[model samples]
Target chain A: MLSVTPQHFLILSFLLVGIGFLGLLIRRNVLLMLMSLELMLNGINVALLTFSRVGSNLDGGIFVFFIMTVAAAEVAVGLALLVALYKKRNSVLSDDMGLLKN
Target chain B: MNAVDLLFWLFAVLSVGGGLSMVFSRHPVSAAMFMIVSLVGVAALFVLLESFFLAILQVLVYAGAVMVLFLFIIMLLDVGPEAGKGKLSHFKTGIFGLLATVLLVGILLTLGNSYDSLALDQSIWPELSESKDGASHSLPFSTKVSSFGYGLMTKYMLPIQVSGFMLLAAMVGVIILSKKTPDREDLK
Candidate 1:
């Protein structure tokens, strides 16, 4: 229990992704769902940094840099869309915006 | 356990616990707050990995900027606490829950099987390599900001430019999406 290994970090990454996925599925609120997406991205970052450290490679860190860039863009677009949807529907629940379900 | 080990466990629990709570929390604001907690924990993990620059970036970018955006949206939309029950029915919830569980278990099993191969016997700390001349050669991996700067300007110059373009496009898209159109009845 005293020694921390790469496996432990990997497990944490997987757990975070798992929880984020669960949130995405069960949560009806679009905002919560987007937050879950951020959680998943963060999990991936942990794994990337772990591999970067393990292989003594700097590319993984740089890749994470790009991932963050994309994530910031994604959240901006996603929230903007959410705001638009809320304005139209007057509700944040995913079930309320099911125009294509039929 | 040593200090590193202790800190690792501490932040590990903090991150994982915060993630779990974020999923189950009723209020959007609380969930966003939990995400901040989780992000801070991940930043600590980055520090443990000896990537001081990335760790600071994680804090500044995720916990600071992204989270503020989330909070602003939550408050702007006035997202109230979810009702006592979720919108997902019992059967759909059960199916999704089982799927998530199986995925997590499968990942755990795979990692466990590969545990031996993943164990590191040598120090993972990066060391800066010395160059005979001041010319740019293949840069050795290090935790120094200079290494990152050099790598970005030399090897990753294209990607950085592309990312900038992408950000610009996303900014335009957000403005278009959120702007009130004069003729569109839906936005009104």
Candidate 2:
């Protein structure tokens, strides 16, 4: 009989983080990068919930709740920025936006 | 393996596979869809962990609101697949892949031996049988939703209010940034 433990959850979280990180590095599209960022946050949220379960601490859960709020706000702001960038340049590629480049 | 373990494996595979697909997908819309799949799987995992409130919130906020925002932006911009720079230069992609693999291996090695030692601190975690408010309780299990509400109203009140403010600020910021105006100074 196989039993899932906190370690199993931890491993899963780590794998998710790795995938998100790799995607962030390899993807050039700003939208895909934002999605990867969300994936990474979701991974961290899983870890927080696992810890909350193991510790029997509602604090971890509360923390994740706050994280969700922050993540929502982040995505809102990020998408707004992406929209602004697209309007300015008519392209969403990170390479195409060299506005910061001197 | 019992039904729970089987379900765990299923959702775990769904999440990881969806994430991988999101990464490899050529089109932004496909990547957005894959992200939804992954987010739903994470919500399922949250359910299995018995954090029903968090699970519901995960589905509501992430799968519902966030994904909708993502799709909205994707549609609004009409962004296409990343202009073919070979998806990524082979050398850089290989380097990132290698780094991620090394990071995963390091984490596994560290957790392999010490995972057991990472047990919950008994003092901080009250048992289900423990009494609250100097009265004995007969609840067989913790009521997470009530407890969560209590904690938010009491201990975490400040941060909760602050988060609300932050969300409001972001909302205003997004409206200002995205809306077109005749005299929009920031756009110029």
Candidate 3:
């Protein structure tokens, strides 16, 4: 039985982050992109918790809580923006959002 | 070989697999489901780290509340499976994939190699007492709910209040933005 080291958690989390990054790149759907953002945040949460455990301190967990709070706020604002975009363009594709480029 | 290790591996696999499927699924609803699974898996990992309070919070906030919000938006939008045909060029995708893979491998190698020396010299606090029996491992610090509550109410009170205010502001903003105003047409 091998011990579950912090290194293992770090690598797994980095893998998750990479997967989320790839999803962000490949997915044109706005909703899926938001989900990818959540994935990336979750990966960062895992890393924070792992470091907290390794250091035997609670600060990391506290930071994770703050991150969750910020993530929630972000989701709220982002969904509102998405709804506005949908109302205006009748589409949720990133390509349809070029109006902001000018 | 041990129960802790076994559970860790299982939850790790579950988390990674769920995340991958969530990203790759074309349907938004199914992708949201996978996201829930991955969130739950991460919560389980939090529990294994002796952060029971955080584990429960993770489940309550992320898996429960946030995901429900996501599902509601997804259902409200009613967008069907995103049509990915002929959107981006294959060369662009290949470039993104290659870049992600290289970044992942580089991070894995660097972190894996340097991890031991990075924090090995520091004295880790709340050091768990080694127990031959797997079930006897106890948290070295008093991480009871009361202590966490005290800390939240005392030392971290300002941030908590700020977060509450932020949440309230977000709620009001969402309501205003999503409201069905008659002038919406004229504004557009």
Please identify model 3 stretches exceeding 4 Å from their true place: B118-142
Q: Which ten residues in a row have the lowest lDDT in candidate 3 chain B?
A: B132-141
Kindly list the per-residue Cα lDDT of model 3 for residues B18-129, writing each as its tens digit. Answer: 9999988989999999999998998998888778988899899988988998899889989899765657788987898898888889988888779775344333224754
- Model 3: residue B13 alpha-carbon error in angstroms: 0.5
Q: Give all TM-scores, in the order shown.
A: 0.94, 0.90, 0.89
Docking quality category of candidate 3 according to DockQ thresholds:
medium
Candidate 1 chain A: minimum summed lDDT over ten consecutive residues — where? A1-10
Please report, as a value between 0 and 1, the fraction of native contacts recovered by candidate 3. 0.58
True contacts kept of each: 0.74, 0.70, 0.58
Off by over 4 Å in 1: B84-86, B122-139, B186-188
Better of 1 and 3 by DockQ: 1
Error of 3 at B30 (Å): 1.0
Give one digit per residue, the lDDT tens place, for model 2 in B1-188.
Answer: 77877988999999999999999999999999999999999999988878889889999999999999999989988888766566457897889889988987898898887876664443212355444652222112344588777777877778989988888899899898878887775647
Over the stretch A1-102, how does candidate 2's per-residue lDDT look in tens digits? 536767778889988988899899888898999999999999999998887776655677778889999998999899899988887788888888888799
**What ordering of candidates by lDDT runs from best to worst?**
1, 2, 3
Off by over 4 Å in 2: B86-88, B118-129, B133-141, B184-188
Model 1 C-alpha lDDT per residue in residues B56-149, reported as the tens digit of each score: 9999999999999999999998989988665678899889999999999999999999988887665434344554343344445578998899
DockQ ranking, best first = 1, 2, 3
If chain B of candidate 3 is superposed on the true chain B, what is its TM-score? 0.84
* Candidate 1 chain B: worst-modelled 10 consecutive residues by lDDT: B126-135
Q: Which CAPRI quality tier does the interface of model 1 achieve?
A: medium
